[model samples]
Target: MGETFTGASDPKTARIMAFGDLFKAASHRMLGFAGLAIALGGLGGLIVMLNAKPEERLLPDPDLTPGAVVDVSLEEMCEPGYAARVRSVDSSERKQAFRMYGLSNVDRRDYELDHLIPLSLGGSNDIKNIWPESRITKPWNAEVKDTLEDVLHREVCAGRERLGNAQWAIRTHWIQAYRMYVGSEPERFVAHSRPGF
Candidate 1:
């Protein structure tokens, strides 16, 4: 006999009606709309903020080649003697001069100037010796750290030698060496040692 049609349809019939498919489509559309709305809101906010302020022209980027050192005289400009004198001022004077003038935290609170080579390593306290870094970062020690890591990499099947090659280009070409005057500690920004001065 045929199944009775007393409006007691099988529960499976409800799924077969494809209501789940319709719900999924609606949900996907709603999610897309939500994402678009959020992106538009962020873009609009950025535009408004930018428009509210007058645009200040930025100075041209300085030549960062090592030879550009001609612009700054090492001896006449950044002597440790001058830095020590600057550090001797009264507390209020420092706050007014350094903080008020936006030269905040531009002094070495720890660590002496590291000659790229220690005087023990034939590194003088000359401008080349001076790269302000944390006391923890001994100049030669930084090189040693890299050497040890390289050794580890060699032991580990010379994993990604190209990464090592690319590292030197970025370090020498992109990085700017700063005069090691009594400036702020070198900020190890991300994977780079950039002087915040």
Candidate 2:
């Protein structure tokens, strides 16, 4: 027959058994709370990542020359008719700029020889200002940039934004402006035209 023990008969053993049970319960609760904390932390990180603005991704143009100057003045280029005549470069010049940027074989149809600082904002026509902007890859393509150019042109002409500052803003980081105004990067090229050059 198995021995039937009572707390009164073996007080020390009873206390030891009770202590062990209590310890086990505490250990389980601690582990559960720790796991929950880790899970919540992971969820918080994912939420932050989802809510934050996407980083601006762009390919660097290796052919950009430092301190290259544009010969044209803002007043001359900012006029309504000036962009058509002044901003156009010859095919050989375009090809040369493309070659300098290591994009020799790229189809001209797929990219625009974009000015880092647009002519309307007094950006130079020099090779330093030109890069092969991808129509497919860039968040803000040539068409979108045309809109930005017009906006800046209006601001500059109206004396709302300084021409030098506008040029610098486009040259320094055009992507940030694109993100600010456009909200997000387009998944693909959106074809639309604005009135006036």
Candidate 3:
């Protein structure tokens, strides 16, 4: 015979060709999936960076008084009537806060005399607990801080978080705490209850 011709010539050759095609298809699919994963990961990182709030680097007044014994517990602050009383902001105190932060020339509407550690988390009314947080700031404004305050208070009241730790977290690095709770920097300051409130 001159030459015998079969589609695959032999069973072994046919099997090898089939496996090669299958391997090529599988590798192509895997490469596509890997590219997609890499693109998605980069996008996620970009979104996080865009939404991340910048740290304010604010420090509470060192000479000011700290939380006193009478106002030391979250339980005491969480009481409806007590919370209301502590939340009160007299005009003089607000002005004093502005002065404390050297913000006398700044517009009052542009900022809030925020408590360094919110009263809802058992922060005292002392000057050390107060600061002038700008509302004009992108993500870490007084309103954003207020949202964190509410969440932390709820956690403390429910025994899911320690009151002392909540206070310390805000005092130490509120922007970081905000990122952890909000999952991104705030784009605007809108007061809405977070999940698990």
TM-score of each: 0.20, 0.57, 0.59
Candidates ranked by TM-score: 3, 2, 1
**Weakest 10 consecutive residues of candidate 1 by summed lDDT:** 53-62
Full candidate order by lDDT, most accurate first: 3, 2, 1
Model 2 residue pairs with clashes: none
Candidate 2 lDDT over 8-31, as tens digits, reads 124423343454344445444544
Give a tens-digit lDDT track for model 3, residues 70-177: 245555767776767857667787778787554656578887777776767766665556767777665456777777777777777878765655655566456555
> Which structure is stronger by TM-score: 1 or 2?
2
For model 1, the local distance difference test gives: 0.28
Return the lDDT, model 1, position 75: 38
RMSD (Cα, Å) of model 3: 24.5
Q: State which candidate has the highest lDDT.
A: 3
lDDT of 1 by residue, 7-39 (tens): 213342233224333433544444455446557
Model 2 error, position 17 (Å): 70
Model 3's number of clashes is: 2
